[model samples]
Target: MQNAGDWTRRLREIGIYAVIGAFLTIISPYNGSGNLPLWGAYLYWTGLVLTGSLSAEATRTLMERTGRKFGVPVMLALMSVTSALAVTAMIILLEALTSGRSIPPGYLPRLFGLVWVIAAAVTAVGIMIERTVLAPVTEPVKGASPEETFLSRLPVKYRTAELYAVSAEDHYLRIHTSHGEELILMRLADAMRELAGADGLQVHRSWWVAKSAVRDTRKQGSKLSLVLPSGKEAPVSRTFQAEVKAAGLSA
Candidate 1:
């Protein structure tokens, strides 16, 4: 379902490229064999943009996959490649469609070279903008919500008992605490994103317990449980029981 969101967002972005391609195709109408109408050109460009700019992971996921720290250069390159592919494919589709038939023999080379060069330019600009401006502005929006900030800046500390981690409850976050968990609203990934610095690990689809609050670790057969400070026990599935144990806590 979240991937559906990503797909939808990708299509919308490609559609923006299509819109630009439509304007350009109209500017210099292809005078080849077909002389396709403006709408057809637009549709072709849209489809092409969708094809070329297929879904790729967002900056964060890409970093995690690469097992390297996120790099400003890499992220910018990715975004630029994304934008250029979307833009280039749209242009090619328009050029081909206007020819009324097959893609031109010489089109492939130009498409390849143009995509890489333009992608580099776009990536550079995108990277510059993100590091210089966008990242600074958006950084606070991640977990530094107003309320969270207020809590952080409180005259007295308040988060001494909270436990945080991803919970896969139909794509929602189930935040656990000494007070027991309340599904405080957030995407599992986004919730994990905010909880990145906290000392907790996602142990299951329905749980994420803090190490400090783990009262006791007990196992019956293969199942393990994390007893909380309040005497409530949260199950630690086999998948993450090892992690809990490795963290020097019993399971």
Candidate 2:
């Protein structure tokens, strides 16, 4: 489900970049500045800008996968620097080929420096659009009613109850809320998807607990478990011990 949302955002980003590229090309100050025809020049600029945008997105993805913690300024700096380098390299190569000019000695550095300035400008615009426009459009509004959020995914009777934990029982899931426990036909993975807005995580392959429902955590030798509001214990597998501890649920 997260991947679906990412894909949707990616498509929207591409569409936006394409439209901006077209607009920039139409009003380009450098149109027909060289041997290239006006139409060809426009196409070239539009394609170049779109290519740069895609490169920026790829860089952002790589940074995210690295999982390195960074503050806002640091993240922006890393992204902008990487994006500028990638786009500048591509632009230099493209310009050399399209302009039919041999790589001028001692001119490469100057060209790259100049191109980086342009790439930096484009990256700034892209970041602004993502934070101000795309983010607001994609993210649910703040202070949403609980009834309209993850709580609504429970069975009709349990909908208004306080959520505790979810346990996978073979092909079904057993939901334990404040009201009572009930078995439902659903996968833990799918249930987690529906509980996106909830503050929780899978403490084991078969168990997911709401942070608020955890009354205590216990460690028996190498194993860990969470004690819920209903006195039900949810085991935490070794695989998830780190996550449980990160949530400050470890004894």
Candidate 3:
């Protein structure tokens, strides 16, 4: 299921990039293919846009994994600059291959500037789409036992135990309960759907905590965590800090 979702997301991204590429081809920005036929222009722009967009996304993901906090504007700027440099090199290579002559050193700076503008625009659009269109839609599970939906999926031993938290680990989820912890082959987003009506909140990108299981809130510098009865702590990311605080889970 996770693999299927991943493929769907990839296809959607490719489709969006392809549209943007087609638009660029129509406009023929910077006279990128002034001498080429229409079909050749389409091929060049589509490939270039797809490559640049993917490169920007990779840089953004790497930046996120660094664990260093950055404002959205700053992160976008950094991603655009990094991707622009990489794409500029690709552009130079492509020009050399097609024109049988390398781009002059004097034109390198201008080329980089053009690439940066396009990179920044595309990067911003991609982020907006991810936050909006690609975000998970969690509807409430209407029933007497909202927790039952997810509890039934737990190991037999933990079916009656109190759920403490659910943390994502690669392709699986680590279910924390009063009895013990168990790993399940499930995505956090899927788990979240089942847990929609449960008395809990997603405290981090990779963590969801039951409200009843929280003993107190812990703060260290700028970091915040929800302390559970079992001595387990669920870290709260900046993105969800406001929701955690509103839920009275913050100190």
Model 3, span 89-160: residue lDDT tens: 888888888888988899889989988998899888876676446533333346636665576655456667
TM-score of each: 0.35, 0.48, 0.59
Top candidate by TM-score:
3
At residue 34, what lDDT does model 2 achieve? Answer: 46
The regions of model 1 sitting more than 4 angstroms off are 1-161, 164-168
Where's the lowest-lDDT run of ten residues in candidate 2? 132-141
Predictions: Cα RMSD each: 13.8, 13.4, 9.6
Extract clashing residue pairs from model 1.
Answer: none
2 or 3, greater by TM-score: 3
Across residues 1-251, which tens digit of lDDT does each residue of candidate 1 receive? 55653465456555555664565455533332145576765665445444443422254356555644333445556665666656565666666566555556687666666665644653454334323333212234465543243123111223443543334555334444433443323456655555566666767657766566777777788888877776766788778877877898772
Total clashes, candidate 3? 0
Which pairs clash in the backbone of model 2?
none
Residue pair clashes in candidate 3:
none
Model 2 residue 105 CA deviation (Å) reads 3.6
